[model samples]
Target: MSYSIVVDHVSFGWPDGTTVLDGLDAAFPAGRTGLIGVNGSGKSTLLKIIARELVPGSGSVSVSGEVGYLPQNVPLGAGRTVSDLLEISATRAALHAIEGGDAAEEHFAAVGDDWDVEERARAELDRLGLDHVGLDRTVGTLSGGESIMVALAAQLLKRPEVLLLDEPTNNLDLDARERLHAAVGAWQGVLVVVSHDRALLELVDQIAELRDGAVRMYGGNLARYEEQVAGEQEAAARLVRTAEGEVRRQARELVETRIKIDRNARTGRKAAENNRVPKIIAGARKRQAQVTAGRQRALAVEKLEEARERLNEAEQAVRDDAEIRIQLPGTEVPAGRTVLTLPLARAAGDDEQVAGVGGKVLETLVVRGPERIALLGPNGSGKTTLLKRIVRQGAQVPVRYLPQRLDLLDDRLSVLDNVRAVAPSASVNDVRARLARFLFRGDRANQAAGTLSGGERFRATLAALLSAEPPPQLLLLDEPTNNLDLASVRQLSQALSAYRGALIVVSHDLPFLETIGITRRLRQDRDGGLAES
Candidate 1:
């Protein structure tokens, strides 16, 4: 069978001697495939290798056609324009020069047969919801989500047979995410996207799970793959129970056989002492009993060993992660208590500007007791700025803000030290115990924040925020799922499940918002107004 991309026995390791992929073998056919895995599992690395951005230490990769890769972090310079990002600057320049009567052979050579490159680029940009973005606009002026969409447009313009995207939806807003989802649905070539976006994954033809240095392909979308895994785990658990029962039964039978053997030996001894039979005949009878007992014992032991092996195999199939579990009674707010209020700013003539988000002015806003509000808007709508303003305003109760950058922890300090810094009243053992619930145990808790991966750093930051001395009664989370993997997102959800506080979260993740039981959905308008959606 023909494959669009083939990775044959690829091996890769970092300069620090940390191995990633070891003799990995995988094939991507001509369709869209969503690559799903936990952070640091080599999904991005594999895509990089296939895109030729990074080379494998050993073995080879084969691609049938042109490959385009959109990295998780697109390099951008402030002075670079949208045209430059699309890689049509030179061609556009040449075309303009020719139009201005400088029709040099070099200009024609550059333009070639693609004179309408600019039109195509603009169309691609418009398709990705960048219709307002101009080719001459500087990259610095565009928001993070806009810049990403522009980069994607550049890739789409290339029209490569094989396209790779890593965390494409990391910085996207609701509208931008929808645009990306549409692009993924419209793609017709060999596409492999490394993302945790469930909506994006739902559009894929297949799901490939990268785990334990290998790839397992499931012939369906994310939901189907999850269903398959859940079924397998259930069967594995049942087999484990069955195997355990067999092991216990074998053990009991072994003990009973041994007891019977002992009784036979005692009987033989008694008969010999009483001279009930000839001495030689009695000795032979005793010898036969001993041999029979030995055989039975060996068979029983073998059966028990087999049962244990089956049980071990069955247990191996079940997958579980150490998730956070803690109740924060101090963080709970009363049902009718006021949590936060935004006072009116004097800048407004008749209408009071209570909050200014991206030049949009909110007349007034109030968040009360145990309310969970989802702050939603497009990128560049000033969600982050509004969050900062809210933080500055101060809450009636203790407030904790988890920024999108996850800058809550000191990089130089260990996870334990970071949490302890926020909760100075807690003892070191107490801090470590709490950190363990966040999946940082023993030496892991002692690791410097600088050394932690994206997900680990997020967890450490969260642990510090929630475990502060004065537990936060008002929690503000900004794009909490930005770079987190699916498992990490789930872990974060698990952690937040125990936080019984009033929350104001800015995120484009509608599914996550629903999961967290958002009581209200607020959208920031282009005119700088906040309204319930």
Candidate 2:
């Protein structure tokens, strides 16, 4: 297969002297490629380097044609119009001037050969399910998911030969995700997307994983990549077992060799002491035995060292995706306990929901016991607002709210301090130990929360909530898996499994909700309407 983009010995790092990528080399074929890695693996950094959004510390990236990139966070401003966000405002203005009988040369120059820029822009936006977003509308009016789709449409309008998307599905609801997936499926150029969305990854032609400072490519989609990795891990596990046995055997043989050597020495000493044979013969035999013993001991030690090296290499092949171990039994709610109750208003019309805007519910709903609830709706359908309201109204039990933006953390505080702030009665060592279960161990617990990557910040925020006083019997999580990588999502699921409290999670990640054992699924309409699904 031919390559569309080639990264040669690329390296990048932050100003803190923290290295993200080192001597990394990767290539993308002329098709959709999904980039996968744990948080802090530099997937976004690599994409930026390729897009020239950020200069690499060393090496270079070679692309076949123009590159268009959609960053993870789409910058939104209230004054910025949709036309400006699409980046065709100038062209549109020039086209308008030309149409109004002003055939100025500069207007023609600005318009270039794209007199149909408006139509093309509209077409792209429509393709991405953003036809309702008027070009003159301010970005502040759009929902987060709408803004993302609009930004993607902006990239597609350029029609670049190479396209890079960083977590494009983030903040998007299920429908928007399908629309984005359809656009990706229809792409005809070299496209690289960094995402953990299984549905988005399923559309990729290949999977490129960044781990341990290197890039490894697997043919086909995420499922194929996972299958291949699973097989490799299974083989590695067998190798590890075999290596362990070999190491044990070699260790035993080494010990046995010493015992034999000592026994021979004793035998030789008796011969020398008793003069069982001629002194000369005895000396010669003893010397020969000593020589043989020395050789045996050298071989035994060498074998043991070799076995250990093999074991180490075999173990390296296995993945060590750390899981968050939430073991707070205090968070457990009684089976019949009422968690929270929210009143909802009546629904307006059954009109299709806008991308983000939604009405508020003013009626009533009750959450009881250790129930797991999945809150699903269009973006801005008051899901997050309702979560905040629940926290504001106060639950029957101690409640903790994890917002979509993860703004609960004090950026200036270290992870340890953040957790301790919530649990003042807990000792520093106890907080540190708990943070370690959240994958912030040792010195890592001392790092400032402001400097953490998206995944790390989520973990830190979660650690604080779980570690809070009274253990937070009612947990409200809004888009909890937004910035999390696939492994981290799995880890989150594992952690939630240990929570015996009530959970109301606002998310579009159906698979994740299923994994967490959601007991009830509720959908909120554009109005304050809440219906059980």
Models 1 onward score TM values of 0.91, 0.92
lDDT, candidate 1, 358-454, per-residue tens: 3434557788889999988888877888889988988798988998888878899999999989899998899988988888988999999998887
Top-TM-score candidate index: 2
Model 2: worst 10 consecutive residues (lDDT sum)? 353-362
Report the lDDT tens digits of candidate 2 across residue range 1-533.
Answer: 78999999998988989999999999889899999998999999999899998999899999999999999987778799999999989988888888899999999999889988888888988888888889999999999899999999988889899999999988898889999989999999989999989988999999999999898999999999999999999999999999999999999999999999999899779868886688788879888998999999999999999999999999998888777876879998889888887775554553434234343333577999999989888887788888878877897899998887889999999999888899999998899889989999889999999999878888888889888998899998989998799987988888898888999999887778889999987888665577666
lDDT of 2: 0.88
Alpha carbon lDDT of each predicted model: 0.88, 0.88
**Clash-forming residue pairs, model 1:** 360-528
Q: Cα deviation of 61 in candidate 1 (Å)?
A: 1.5
